[model samples]
Every structure is written in C-alpha cells, then in structure tokens.
Target: MISELIANAVVHGSAGLDEPIFLWFEGSSECLRIEVRDSSAEPPTVRPVEPEDESGRGLWLINELALTWGHGPRDDGPGKRVWVSIAPAHMGLL
Candidate 1:
C-alpha cells in the first residue's frame, strides 16, 4: 500500500520537480491514514485496465486495499495529495 502510493506520487505526480515527496501518517489502532504529496499540480486518476496490461493497477490496488481513498490539490503548495485509509488489521498492527 505504501509503495503504491509513493509510486503514484513519483510516476504520476513528480514529473521533473525538484521538491521531495511528502509522506504523512495519522490515526490509531482502529484506522490509519496514509498521505503522499508530490510537487505536481495534476490529479491522479484510475483508468480502465485490460487483462494483459502490466501496469496501471496501482490505484486499483489501492482502492481494493484501502477502507477509503482520495486525492486533491495541496492545501499549502503547488502540488497534490493522494491519500488512503485502512484498518490496522490490514497493516498487521492489530
């Protein structure tokens, strides 16, 4: 889950930017939120994937694993944040 979110930030959001990706975590044993922020203004999207495609499944995987997921423009900079929420059990923390 962390890899997918970071990869999305690097592949889809950090296209030629000098800024580093910002990672954040919040919540408790019941639930946790992971946020990946990158220096691109473009939003992330989940497009249709075919059976033979080798990629384009990161967001799909995130959707399947996360309790909830979303992305939006950064509140403090010229970038965006893609985030996911998941149960602690999924993280083996419970």
Candidate 2:
C-alpha cells in the first residue's frame, strides 16, 4: 500500500508541479500508517473511467482497498500529503 501510494505521488501527484515528494511510514502493533507528501496544492481526485480505459486506476484502487485514506495540506509547503492506514491482519507478523 505504501509503495503504491508513493509511486502514485511521484508519477501523478508531482507531475509538472516540480514539488518535493516526501514519504513517511510508521507502524505499531495494531496498524500501519503511510503518508506521501507532494508539492501540489490540488488534491488527488478519483474520477470515473471509461470502459476501454487501459490505465488511471492507481489511487482509485488505493481508496477502494485501503482501510482509510485521505489527503490534506502539508505542514511546511503549499502542496498536499496523502495518508492511509490499515490494520494489521495478524499480530506480530512483521
């Protein structure tokens, strides 16, 4: 999940924005939290796709598959950061 979001942030989020993209990951016994910050004020929006569309399903899949996900302004920039958290499927697995 973290990898996917971060990749999306780098490929799509920062496109033409020339902004720094930062990734933070933290985990506890219960869950993992991942955040990706990019230099774009505009947030990532999940839009509808056509039937024959061959791409554009990254963030959409994340939103649908993640336990919870959101995007907001970064603390030190004009861009935004996207965050997602998912509960551990098994205790002490990692």
Candidate 3:
C-alpha cells in the first residue's frame, strides 16, 4: 500500500522532473493512517481495468484494502494529499 501510494505520486504527480513529495504516517496501536503529498492537485482515480492490462491497479488496490481513503488540498502548499487508513490487523501489526 505504501509503495503504491509513493509510486503513484512519482508517476502521476510529478512532471517528469526530479521533484519533491511528502509522505506522512499517523496513528496508534489500533489503526494507522498514511498520506502522500505531491505537487499536483489532481486526485487519483481508479481506472477501469482490462483483463489484459498489466498495470494501473494501484488506486484500485488501495480502495479495496484500505479501511478508508481520500484526498484533499494540502494545507501547507499547492497540490494535494492522498490518504488511507488501515487497522493493525491489516498490516499484521496486531
């Protein structure tokens, strides 16, 4: 999940240049929240998958597995933050 978020930020949020992005994690023993911030304000979408498609499933996977997920404008800057929450059981941390 973390990898998917980061990769999406790199692939979708950046404009082919080496740009900075932000990642955040917050929570306690029961649940964890993850956020990825990038320079693009566009929110991610779960694209329709073709049976033979080899990729484009990142958001779809997040949607299916995350307890909750969403995005909003970044508080500190331009672009946006994509976030997800998962229970400890989901990560085997319980």
Candidate 4:
C-alpha cells in the first residue's frame, strides 16, 4: 500500500528527483495507517481503467486492498499527503 502511494506521488505529483518524499507509518495490533507526502498540491484520484490499458492501476489496487484511503494538503508546506489505513483483520499479513 505504501509503495503504491509513493509510486503515485512520483508519477503523478510534482515531486522532483531532488525533492524529498516523506512516509509515515502508524499501527498497533489492530490497524495500520500509511501516508506518503510529496511536493504537489494536486490531489490524487483513481483513474478509470480502460480495457486495453497497460497501466494506471495503482489507485485501484489501493482501493481494493485498503480499508480506507484519502489525500489532503500537507501540514508543513506545499503538496499533498496520500494515505491508507488497513483494518485489524488484515494486519497479520503485514
């Protein structure tokens, strides 16, 4: 989930090679939350899949695997933070 979010930030966000990407992970025995921060104000959205499409399935995969997911403005600076939370039932696989 975290990897997908980071890839989305790199591919879709305005993150440059020199820019830093921040990752946050918070979890207990029950649930886990993952956040990826990049230097783009544009929010991430799930793109519609086409029948012959060879790519663009990251968000869709996240939607299927995560209990919940979303994005919002960065707290410290410009850009957006995309996040996902996994429910307790799925934590054991981590």
Which candidate achieves the best TM-score against the true structure?
Answer: 3
The TM-score of candidate 1 is 0.87
> Could you give candidate 3's per-residue lDDT for residues 38-62 as a string of tens digits?
9898889999888899999999999
* Most accurate candidate by lDDT: 3
Quality of model 4 by C-alpha lDDT: 0.86
Local distance difference test scores for all models: 0.88, 0.79, 0.90, 0.86
Better of 2 and 4 by TM-score: 4
Output the better candidate (2/4) by lDDT: 4
Compute the lDDT of residue 52 as modeled in candidate 1: 100
Q: Which regions of candidate 2 fall more than 4 Å away from where they truly are?
A: 15-18, 90-94
Which of candidates 1 and 3 is the stronger one according to TM-score? Answer: 3
Q: Which residue segments of model 4 deviate by more than 4 Å?
A: 90-94
Error of 3 at 20 (Å): 0.7
lDDT of model 1, residue 75: 96
Better of 1 and 2 by lDDT: 1
TM-score of each: 0.87, 0.79, 0.90, 0.88
lDDT for each residue of candidate 4 in 1-94, tens digit (9 for 90 to 100): 7778878888888567888889999998778899998999988878899989998889999988898899999998989899999986764564
